[model samples]
Target: MAKPKFLIKTWGCQMNVLDSDKLAGTLMDLGYEPTPSEDEAEVILLNTCSVREGPENKVFTELGRLRPLKKNKLKVLGVVGCVAQQEKAAIFSRAPYVDLVMGPRSIMHLPELLEQARHQKALEAEFRDDSVLYPGGKISRSHPVKAFVTVMEGCSKKCAYCIVPFTRGREIYRPLESILSETREAVDSGFTEIELLGQNVNCWKDGATKGFADLLEAVSGVEGVKRLRFTTSHPRHFPLEAALLMAERPNICHYLHLPLQSGSTKILKAMRRQYDKEWYLDLVRQIRSRVPDIALSTDVIVGFPGETEEDFLETLEVVREAEYDAIFSFRYSPRPGTPAAKAEPVAGEVARERHQRLLDAQLPIQTRRLKAFAGRTIEVLVEGRSKRGTEWMGRSGDNKVVNFTSTGQPSVNTYLQVTVERAGANSLFGKAVTAKNEAPGAKCKA
Candidate 1:
């Protein structure tokens, strides 16, 4: 008998991407094959994200588009991830064709759920016991150079604007030894970079690894790992030691993505982010004191519930003061069941205007930042060809995208020192300064 094929469509954060990967691994374990194309698959899973309004809309739009597949003899059409957890019964009500609805907590029970859904309906969103490490086991890795190793699952912080807690449940840390073992396996597999993923990564505190700082220190010691990084840290729980560790460790990339959702102290208090503007600025000061040229990125919501123009200005003030390398700015979109949803949102045009203002404010700063790199030589971890394929592309240790034409086919997963010749709005144009095993200013080995 031919094995059944599955396709997982993921929309949202790195955690969702990793969850989709886990789903793929789980399906493979159950003797199901993965298909790159959706039409050929007998099973389709939508690993969702409900943190923001945009991704939530994407899920429904995609489901509507895939409605025809239900009649194509598709065995399973499941909805997984944050949206599944957030809109449990409503999904079946809105899109009656969906076969199964499982949240992050239900991931490990996929095979059983699939079997059950075959005979009867299944919806598994309730938080399960934390005794088992979530998303357990590792069967395969798709990337040759980059890998996202989830050190923990879920979020304990129930910020008013976020639906993560409702979807992902409480925070649970994976054992430190499991993380170390996985890092070693990636190294043995020739992967160079390991990105530690979590909703609030710096909040990690397993008994085996008491703090995220300790986890970074341990992972840095893993041989063959060239670069180490973590993501989506909350300002409230971002440990001081983690910043210091980033400064001390050469392998840890000098990049921090701390989300300062709203700049106004009152708005922040309303959002229950647990950190004020003063605290955020002070934290930024402390981090820059440790690594002065550290490339910083942030997530900003321009308008929030009860947000005033004054509040919007305060957000702009923080953005101007912070001078981030990039900002993922968004207009506040009230999500279902969150406290913020009940509150009156900023007027649509007003929100859109503020969103544009935030982007506009960041534009000159980002452009200037990229321009400053011109004539400076920086190490870039080769990713692959640029979009046009006329040039090679990679990221510097600071996480700035650099694209340059090479003499021959560029090798991925290698390192190169490129001196910036020019700058674009968000990326840099450069020429080779050195390649792997070559001295500074030496000709690149095609």
Candidate 2:
């Protein structure tokens, strides 16, 4: 008989992608082969995100499309991740065909849930006190060169407009030993780049003795780790030591995603971000003082409840001052049950206008910053072929996407020096110069 097949359609951040990998790994362990085709699978899991209203709506639309499949086939249809946790039994009411509704924290009980789903509806949305660590498993990693290791899960920061805490529960830090062990395993499995993942990554701590900076130093010391990175750090939790470590460590990537939700101090307070504009800028200054060439990216929300015209302009002012290489900007959409959801909302048209203005202000700044790389050579980790296919795609240590042409076909996952020929706001274009050797002006730690 042919082996059973499973398909996991994932939506959301890096954390969600990693969750899908764990779910796939679990199913693979249970004798199920992963299939890309929805028609060929015996099990289908929708690993979801409820970070924003848009993604949440997309999940429901996807479920509607899967309704015919669920009705026609004997497939075990499941909804898992943040949306599952948020909706609970409501998912069953919305899409009665779904067989399982499991949350991010409840992933460990997947085997039992799968068994129970075979006969009747299965639900597991309870949050666990302990960390959800996948110690040993064959994870179906999305990227061949890079591996994402979760150092922590969930967010403790209760930002007013955010829904993360409700969906993912409170903070749960993974043990230091478990993190190092996983990093070693990933390196042994030929992954050169390891990205530490979490809801608020820099907030990660191991008991009272160790913190995120310590974790960075430890992971950088791992023998085969060529590059190390972490993401979605909260400004309040980001330590100066982490920035200093990035400057000193050869393997640590010089990239930081410090979110500036609203550049206006008043708006930030309204959002309960904990740090004001002056404080955030001071932190940025400190990081830059240590690593001057480090590339910085940020998340910005244009319009929030009670945001004034002056508040929007303040955000634009901060954007100019910060000089972010890239900005992930969004218009605020209130999630139900959040404090902001009960408050008066900004008009849709006003929000849209502010969002456009914010993007307009950032575009030239981003372009100018990226253009600085031209005529300089940088170290790039070759990821794979680019969408154009004529050039290869890779990323710089600062997390800039570098697409370069090589004289000869360079193998993926190898480090190469690329002389940047030109740059756009979105990416850098270049040609590979040498293999596995440092070039002058390379934006990497000594």
Candidate 3:
């Protein structure tokens, strides 16, 4: 009599990764053991993403591959997260072997769904307004030194190209108290860095008065939190106060991932991004003025419907102007049920060309940004051994990856002062100078 074994194949963003952890924790509570191998598991869950056409298709291909496993063994197969929410009962028709389908909002009903699936096929995609915050449960965190705390869930903005509103439902803010409690718990459990996560993270508001800036200030006050960060902020919701706070607070990481999807105001209007190019660039300027050492990154989607050659060039121009440390660029893929999906699409070859051009334009900008760190000593929170395993790797407060060699092995989760010997486009190569208990006043010193 062995405990049931479960395997989860995850895809998509950091949020999905965290959700997988919660799902694993929940299954563990039900006396199930986790197995990395799919063949050995009694239960297999595909925690999916439907952000683009590519990942959604990958999920189906994986499910088709698992069809043999489901037939050969007495195994329970399920689909969860955005893809499940978007596809709903259609998943069963496409892959009859799927036993359970649950949405992001329906995670709390997992136990009941599992019970129902034992008897018959189960589906739970209902959007529950009250269940915005994840109920307290065991979380098998993926990272030892850093914790991802969900400050909010889902997206409110109805961007023309996005399917997030359809899959994840409207925005819901986690209560302030719950957020603080989780932060405290994470810090107490030895996580020194806390990254607040959400779809439009900077838009988070508590009641009528408090907002993301207030939340940042409160989290920074928490004891033992060495670094604080948040991600995927909407340019429209990002206020100057947040930038001012980042400048004033040493604990808050000087890194912001503000997405500028398009640079041409006309293209942005079609995309319904809510802000024009000037507005976004002004926000960037304001943030940089306040936090001069801040590292900026962005997302760019090329070949949106009706995008002209001028529009793509504008995007390249903005990339040059913004001077991002990194750019996550993608070719536009129409998502079903979104308004943009119904519109005329750019030519496939054209889209592909534009995507490469965008990346090409940003390479030198990124290379120069990283190269500037050379000859400077920066504080890095040692995460673990680098992929090559020759040296240790970690990130600075500005979220640049630093890989350094040391005479003595530096402990994971400890801070080290590393003087950059050289830098590549993607990362800085350095040598650890000292193991420090406390971070200095500034992140980088020349």
* Model 3: colliding residue pairs: none
Cα lDDT, model 3, residue 444:
25
Error of 2 at 191 (Å): 0.9
Per-model TM against the reference: 0.93, 0.96, 0.95
Tens digits of per-residue lDDT for model 1, 44-82: 999888877787888888888888987885878899988
> Model 1: what TM-score?
0.93
lDDT of 2 by residue, 56-124 (tens): 888789889988887655469898989899887778888888888888988777887898888886555
lDDT of 3: 0.86
Residue-level lDDT tens digits of model 3 in 1-446: 98889999899999898888788878888899998878889889999999987888898899898888876554678999899999976788898878888888877667777888877865554666644566443777777577888888889899999999888888899988999988888776777799998899888999999999999999999988889999879999998898998999999999989899999999999999999999988888889899998899999999999999999999888889888999998889899899999999999999998998888899899999999999999999888898798999999999999999998867778889999999987999999998554543222211
Name the weakest run of 10 consecutive residues (lDDT summed) in model 2.
Answer: 437-446
Error of 1 at 257 (Å): 0.5
Off by over 4 Å in 1: 122-126, 129-139, 435-446
